[model samples]
Target: MKIKAINGVKDILSDEIVYWQKIEKTARDIFRRFGINEIRLPILEKTELFARSIGEATDIVEKEMYTFVDKGITMRPEITASLLRAYVEHGLQVRQPIQRLFSIGPVFRHERPQKGRQRQFHQVDVEVIGAQEPQVDAELMAMGQMLLNELNLDVSLEINSLGCPECRPDFRKKLIAYLHERHDSLCDDCKRRIEKNPLRVLDCKQQGCRAMVQEAPSIVDNLCSACEEHFAAVRKQLDRLEVSYTLNRFMVRGLDYYNRTTFEFLTTDLGAQAAVAAGGRYDGLVEQLGGPKNTPGIGFAMGMERLCLLMQQQEGQQEEQGGADIFIAALGEQAIAFAAPFVHQLRKLGLQAAMDYSNRSLKAQMKQAGRLKAGFTLIIGEQELEQGRGILRNMDTQEQNEFSLQEGAAMLAEVIAPDKA
Candidate 1:
């Protein structure tokens, strides 16, 4: 019998790791620019935290989350709930009136994997907790725009308001009335969800269900005066900032927590997995989850896999598979003995240098160097070691030259690192 990786989880292998590193670095730099502090939360949390915050009726809680009934814990399906849990547990509001926090980590679910959707995926989550102003919502969306723009990705932003506890009920009533009129026409999943979670039906992908929802009333039309005012303020700020956005009535997030504002960064390239990032305001969530009442916050989480997918589709966008800077091919016993310290000195000078550890034949070592895509290969033979010199070969041009072994760094710098030279 053979062992294999779990069906839906995949490995980030060597050649592909550089791209992941680049994505993480870009997120960190952009996040830093916004003064968002990085937060590290545990992958496992009390199951009740999410069930209470994300709502038991949502797909994540009822169908997708990886719950552990016996241990009373569950792997987090998203970071927002966990972040909120941390905020309450640590009493973050007391430390600062507002906190801008971000996290980049893996999240787990039990769904079948597809091209851009994985059972175990990663997300870059950004949250601004404790602010009730619509300007913060506009800034959050703008920052998302900037991050994707920096990545050279083509994506569009769409936003909707989910009307808070004060207003969502009337919209919910209207939504349910419309959904009931066409309940039989909807898919079974949607038919079941309409009564318990009508907002979920609006996001259904089933063709028949989507057609049925097209005629249903939008929450925007049913928002109470307060919600309407808040929604208007948010759009006004976004307009002032020149951040273009579409008003997507059907873009209600799949969580029960969201209210007042819900937005997503979408791309058409990935079929059903269209949203690269999505989030919203959850004014009632902190109080709902046993924190200070009326606490307001907004956030967004970008799927790393989907972002990478869109990144791969962009024209002229190259995958950065960083190769070795220098390879020291040590031949003969004396040359092999001289390899370690020689490579160390090159590295101390900031060169990514490596040498043969097994002391393979010169031909074999040279082949390895070529395989590694090293820019330059240094050949140190017995005679060269005795003479305190080594031959440097340009792997690309196959041009050969010599330099003092004691001056290996300076010699390599002349051709490869001219600035250092």
Candidate 2:
């Protein structure tokens, strides 16, 4: 029997790695500018962490999590739960009143794959902890916007509030009662949620569930005084920063720990999986995960694969492959001996340089140079090696010139240097 990769997973080959590198570099540069340091959390966590934070009734916790018992400990499906665990156990004790943390790594979800959605996906996550102030929310959103803007991705921001615990209980009761009236019209999952987790009914993506909840009561309308005030402050801060957004009353995050502010950075270009990024305030998450009380926080996570897909679609092109600045083609045994040191000298001067190791003929070496997309080709034949000189051909313009070995290296270095070039 031939073994193959499991379904819903795919390999990232060399040709596609440049796009990933570009996106990660852009994210890292933007995050650094915003004063958010990178934090790496383990891929696995105690399964109970997600159960308490993401909630037992949600799709992620119920159907998608890759949970397993390992030597009496349960492993988790995703990294966000681990992120929260790290923040509470280790980050909280630090003196910093506010911590800005970012992470980029793989997360597992057992969903059927399509287009950009995968069973194993990567996420770029950012979290701001120990700050209940609405400005922190605005700042977090701003950092996301900055990253998108830097990438030149045309995306829209959708904002909502899930009301704090003080008001959500009443809202859940009203929502459940409304769903009970339309119980016969709901899908089986929504029907089950009506009793177990009434709030989840609003998050269903099924056509029938969507239609049934069109007139359902919004959590925004039932916000408690404090929750309403916090939401208002968040909006006011966003307005002051001139961040454009749509008020999406139905945008309840999948996590149960979220409170007050919730958001999703969406793009219609990605088909049904339109959300490129999504997250919210989880003020109660710390306490839920056996840590401090009332430690409010907000953050967001972007699917790197989804972002790359969107970028490819929006740009209508793939990133051009990077190549060496020069290719040294040797013609004979003597030329080969001379070319080795010359190529190393070019590289030491900070120029991308490469030479054929297979000892092919002159014509074949030239062809290989072209295939490598080398900007310039240095032809070191017997005559040139005898004279300590070589022929340089500009691959782009097909212009040929002759120079001594040392002179050619100096000229290439000059072209690469700012002042001399």
Candidate 3:
């Protein structure tokens, strides 16, 4: 019998790390340019935090969250609730009236794993707290667009407004009534969603449920006067920024906190996981979680795994293995002792250097240098030690130059340095 990883989780091997690093690097650069600071949060929090923020009736809270019932703690299934909790507890609001923050890390969920979705997945979450203006929503969506564009991903932006509490009750009532008429045909999930969370029916992926809601009341049309104006302003800002988007009347977020200005970046490349990134405005969430009242917020999250998958799917996206600046091949014990210290010297001078510690044959070491794609190889042997010089061969051109052992590391560092070259 062999020990194996958990069924729903995945081990990200080194060869696949390049794609992940690219995604994270591009996201961090984008976030920096947008003035968003990075934040780190714990992987676990009180179960009530999610129950209060994600809605107790939602599938995430009811089925997916990995909760320790006795401890009342859960491995966070999402970043927003824990982030908000930190915001309130640390008095981040008092420090800065408005916060522009982002976090990148893994989150947990106890759901069936699929290609781009695992039990433990990573996300780059961005949030702006205490900013209620429609421009905030537009800019946030624009930032998401910029990030995906930089990543060279083929994703489209879709926007929707869930409407604020002022007018949502009436719309919820109407939506519930519309769902009731098709009660017999609704999927089991949507059927139950009617009374507890009618808005979620519009977000269902079931073919029958999707068809049923095509003619259902559009939440965009029923927005209250304030929400209508706010949504219009958001669209106007998006137009000013020249950000292309399509209106998705049926787009409703799964979380309870979302209201008005919802959006997602979707790509057809990923089959069932069409959304590569998604989020929306949650005006009352901070207050609901014990923060200051009326603190408006909006943010979005990009799935790292999905982004990496898309990167891998793209033709010519493979990352070339980086080569060492220099490789030293030492023939025997004396040469090994001399080459070892010289390798460290090159590294301290900001150069990538590699040398075999296994004391392998010169031919084997040369092969290792080729595999590493080393730019140059310095061959040191007992004869060379006696002669006080070594042969430096350019791996690419096979041109050999006499390297003086008297000057040693300093002269070698200058000779190999790109700027010096």
Candidate 4:
């Protein structure tokens, strides 16, 4: 019996890897220009790391985390907690007051998967640690915009402030009071969230819960003096950078650590899964997670699977060109022997060289070359071997040229890739 992949997970085969490669490449280039360095972390961490950082009330901690109860380890549902854990454990603050870092990897969650979401999904997380200035928040959003722009993705940006510890309690009380009045009308999830995390009810998607919260209090209106100033400064800097954005007062982060400025990049192409990227400030989290006191941070993560889906939707699946730069079709056993080493030499010179090992007929080999979409086909038959030359045909133009067989790979490399040769 053939085994099948488990539900909520799928393989990214060769044909689809090109989109991922382009996304990663574009991200790296943008990160480099922004002076952001890369970081890598383990997939598993002590369950307490998430419980403390993500908050036990979160859906990720309550229902979605893939935890081994006996082992006390859990697969990471997101990257921020693990990154903050690293920052504190390694005393990264001693080396630099502020560190700009990014990480690319898969994060595991136990959600019911749908289009653009999987049990194991990839994300590109960017963080600015130890920077509390409002400009840092603005610049981070700008960096996200630049990355999406370079990818040619048309996504809208929405910003909001979740306030801070100083003033959020007032908003929470007011919100909870509002929720309690309509308690029976809310969804079971929102009803539970009312006490544990009243803010999450504002983010609920259910029609009933969403309608209940339409008249709810806005956190942006409840910011403390300091938080209000910081938020205003963030908006001012974003304006200075000419980064366009709309205010979303009801926006609330799924994680408990977020505070102050929060934002998401939205797209209409992905149906209900509208957010392609999202993030916010977490001023107190570094200290909460055993890092030095007052080490402020803000970061964002782009859902790679969602980004790829948007890319495929905008440009067809086969938009990226794949296959060999050149295909060597050797007709006879003697020709195959000669072409084998010749192809290897071309590869060493930085060329995507492919040759069929099967000693098939010339017509069959040419057909294989066509299937590979080879730019050039080098035909070496008994006749060409006798002539001490090979006929290189430009697959596109169908123009053939004779090259001295004795010169071998060097002569061919120069012809195919003049810049490299």
Clash count for each candidate, listed in order shown: 0, 0, 0, 0
79-146: candidate 4 lDDT, tens digit per residue: 99999999999999999999999999999999898999999999999999999999999999999999
For model 4, what is the alpha-carbon lDDT of residue 210? 82
lDDT of 2 by residue, 1-421 (tens): 9998889788988878877888899999988888888888776677777777788888887788776756323444555667779877885547687888889998888999899998888889888888899888988897888888888899999999999878999999999999999989999998998978787788888999998898999999999999899889999999998899999998887777788899999999987898999988988887778767777778889999998887788874468678768898988788888788878877777778889867788789888888888988888889997787788888889999876776766676675333433
| lDDT for each residue of candidate 1 in 1-421, tens digit (9 for 90 to 100) | 9999998898978766766777888889998898999999999999999989989888899989898899989999999999999999999999998989999999999898889888999999999999999999999999999999888899999999988777778888888988888878989999899779989999999899888888788989888899999999999999999999999988788888889999999998899888999999988888887889878999999999888878778885688675678899988777788888878877777777888888789899998998888999989888888888788898999999887777657566666766644
Our model 1 lands, by Cα RMSD against the true structure, at: 1.8
Q: Rate the local accuracy (lDDT) of all candidates.
A: 0.88, 0.83, 0.92, 0.93
Cα lDDT over the full model 3: 0.92
Better of 1 and 2 by lDDT: 1
Between 2 and 3, whose lDDT is larger? 3
- lDDT digits (tens) for residues 1-421 of candidate 3: 9999999888999788878888888988988998999989999899999999999999999889999999999999999998999999998999999999999999999888898899999999999999999999999999999988888888999999999888899999999988899999999998888899888889899999888899999989999999999999999999999999999999999999999999999999889999999999999999999989999999988899999898889766777657898999999999999999999988888888999988899899999999998999999999999998999999999999999988878788778775633
Clash pairs, model 2 backbone: none
TM-score for each candidate, following the candidate numbering: 0.95, 0.94, 0.97, 0.98
lDDT of 1 at 52: 94
